[model samples]
Target chain A: MNWLGLVPFAIFSLLFLLLPTFNIVLGAFRTQQGAATLDNVMNLAQPRIAIAFWVSIKLSFASALIGCLLGFILATTVALGGLPRWLRQSTLTFSGVASNFAGVPLSFAFIATLGRVGILTIVIREVFGINLYGLGFNLLSFWGLVLVYLYFQIPLMILIITPALDGLRREWREAAEILGATGFQYWRRVALPILWPPTLGTMALLFANSFGAIATAVALTGSQLSIAPIVLFNQIRGDVLQDPQLGYAIAFGMIVITGITNLIYIVMRVRSERWLK
Target chain B: MKSARLWSYLIFLTGVMYFIIPLIGMFEFSLRKRRGEYSFDAYTSVLTDAQFQQTFLYSLLMALVAIVFGILLVVPTAYWVRLRLPKMRPVVEFVTLLPLVIPPVVIAFGYIRLFNTSSVLPFLGSQFGTDVLLSCGYVVLALPYMYRAVDTGLRAIDILTLTEAAQGLGANWPAIIFRVIFPNVLVAVLSGAFLTFAIVIGEYVISALLDRPAFGPYLVWIGSNKAYEPSALAVMTFAVTWGCMALIQVVTRFSKHTRTSI
Candidate 1:
């Protein structure tokens, strides 16, 4: 058999994933004239990089947490047959559409819907005499980006949470009821514990997902923000660093962060499988 | 108990509002006539706009290219890995998937530096070349979903035995992989293709980065000008995507029914 064809696939995967990273790591460790140096990485250890890194972590955590919880509530409501089948299906479909929706067009949709000159903002100001700008609803701020991310993030939560709810085992709920447990008691004593691990896992995936995403920040907030991938994108195109090497360095940093987050996700997923089994 | 049921009904109503209200707003904004009553003028104007029409075609063409290549490439990778490389499974698994956890913007940046002028590859020297390079990036971007579907489908079939049987008949690996093994994973490929189509058709990051005049950039154009046309475009985009989603559902149901009957 021609097992050698397999070699091409193996090599292609390795090279595609490796070479870009290689260019970056190599660039970051090189002199201005291309001699070996550690200055780039060392400079990254400076206070500015640290602050940006910490900020990204905190913001990603906040958005992912809120999104996961929102997703959980919505998913449980639907999965418990809180809605009829047709409605549930449509909502699920809409959730899929919204969750997949991101980038500039998504930002535009939100801006048109909620921006300063946006329809809702105009209507709210006209009908209720509520100044949204006074209320700080600008679509060009850190919080504004978070608000737009919520559009998709909540739907992602539903996608992950609905499956877990399906596996909730209705018999367990019935058994709890038979034992004279209240609904909250039944959920607390039985359901939440079973769902906790995957819920945690799903939330982590969402965190990593929104964290790595740069387009939302790009379209909504631009480089006035300090998000890592946004910074990296600017380094590449904006050339604020004024050197292609800086672009490689930023790409290298993004890869490392995404790699680490993905590792955590893999571990969590493994744990979830174990818990379920 | 009756009150709890009523509470559930209320929750359902809220859910409907949550999903439908945004769409309703998009529709009202799209259909309203500035000079008169409701009209189809905005949509007709959007469809007739040459750039919009071209971008729509360009996006459909990009999606079709990725969908075809994704099916051809991912199916074999998923199949060959399942049959021959069970020991190296997780590594192969993670390799195809590293794209997902890595943000698209990061990858888009990677493309710029990796493919920009004066890079190792001459292909990145121009915008057209960069656009195709962007397509390569799209293939990678869609890899996680496509690979996952194929991997799951491979697990559902006993491919090793089939490979052995084909080998015993003096069939070579390519013949077996292409003819016998490929047909078995059709459903997975179909589902993955639909997903790839949905993703690539509406893709904005790679297109925006590579500075291609695809549907996403066109949408941004319409958004800045004819407000109602942009809303109409959004509704159309939503319809197309939802249609693909419905295709996935139908394919899954058809596959499920087939498995049950067989």
Candidate 2:
């Protein structure tokens, strides 16, 4: 009788979420006539598809690494760096907002700030007499997207890692001090050991977060960049490659990558929670 | 300690600058619609645009539908899982978190492939059907946050006790869920709803692929077509997101205050 309560929810999930995903995963392996084959999956080795996957991975890695470093620094400064209470409070509130402020508007904001004829670009050219374009900085390039991604990625990192930082326990630091440990020695021996798990976990989450991003990339770079999401977007819109199964393969590959990263994140989070507890 | 504090402040200032410069630049750029003078021309244009109005309203309606449907689906399930199916907690959690692992583009692709006009369930056969599919996609995208919020709220209140008391009073399941459990977790539900609104309003991949007139696709369309107006729209979008987060804070604080007063 009680099991009947989950019926509607179960039906909704099965229909909308599970079945669609299962269809995609199933399509990735099947041929046009529905015969199971490895041809589509093997087609992922083509230069176009492979390059898209590689670029996507590199972008995700760069943004996640940089976001983690910067976010950890900012979070540490606020949580343990003797900042005023109000600053910390406001920083957190701002982070909660900024982390969710991704997709198209974020790309728009970045373009207005860094695009050609953008205010900062004009300012730099007028004041410093140096053209950012001449300096080989294009907002549509790889590094440009990383910079834009960092806007939200860093805030997300700060939000996720703050509690773990708070769990660093003042007693442990004081105890290390009383044991004649230097600051560097304390961090190396005590703090870093404890913090590394959550930091790395957050990096994994950040990687997956940016890995799956499409709107910001599409809005900012158009179809100029061959990142996996954009490629998939184009494929879905018009079948640019004229092969729907290869598109499924690409989407399958994305699911696999993000799935692995998120799995790592969950594992690392569990390990860190044990220690934090 | 002195040097450490100074270093912290330096890093903090740098972070602040990195975050603030784009916003300042955007605002400044948005005012550049008129040569040699700052004006709100760009904002006015964006605000008055017909496509913007239509797409914004369409996304807003979709967001509302997603929130209501999400609450209906999630609240009862979360309540029941807590009260009756505690052993299935991990499975429920993993299923909820699947959206985070699977990208929105992939999910949207799956929907296209599975529910196209030729498929058994032709959700994309019409605009209304596609809108339903898009709303369900938003709910899936937001499942992680919504489920976590409701679950955290359930943990705060004693569901077992509430359910037992409601049962002793001869109330049915729907009444207990709606009357007893729902009120207790209203704050959590509202927080989740605001987050959902934030996500659905600016969503791009699902709605874009589905060919829906959503604000996200509209933003992207304008971004490519217009110059300064994109910045003004960006500012507006940022405010909407900020408003959502702010409301979540306000409600959570309000809930705490009422609890303390009680």
Which residue segments of model 2 deviate by more than 4 Å?
B258-262
Write down the TM-score for model 2. Answer: 0.98
Question: Would candidate 2 be rated incorrect, acceptable, medium or high by CAPRI criteria?
Answer: high
lDDT of 1 at B58: 92
Tens digit per residue, CA lDDT, model 2, A1-277 = 8788778878888888898888889999999899999999999999988999999999999999999999999999999999899999899999999999999999888888889987788989999999999999999999999999999999999998988989988899999999999999999999999999999999999999999998999899876789998899899887586889888888999999999999999999998998898
Model 1, residue A13: what's the lDDT? 54
Name the 10 consecutive residues with the lowest summed lDDT in model 1 chain B: B253-262
Among these predictions, the greatest lDDT belongs to 2
Each model's C-alpha lDDT? 0.73, 0.91
Per-residue alpha-carbon lDDT of candidate 1 for residues A10-54, written as tens digits (9 for 90 to 100): 665554555555666678878679898777776666565656667
Tens digits of per-residue lDDT, candidate 1, B1-25, equal 7776677777767756655555666
Tell me the DockQ of each model, to 2 decimals.
0.43, 0.86
lDDT of 2 at A108: 83
| Chain B vs. true chain B: TM-score per candidate | 0.94, 0.97
Among the numbered candidates, top TM-score falls to: 2
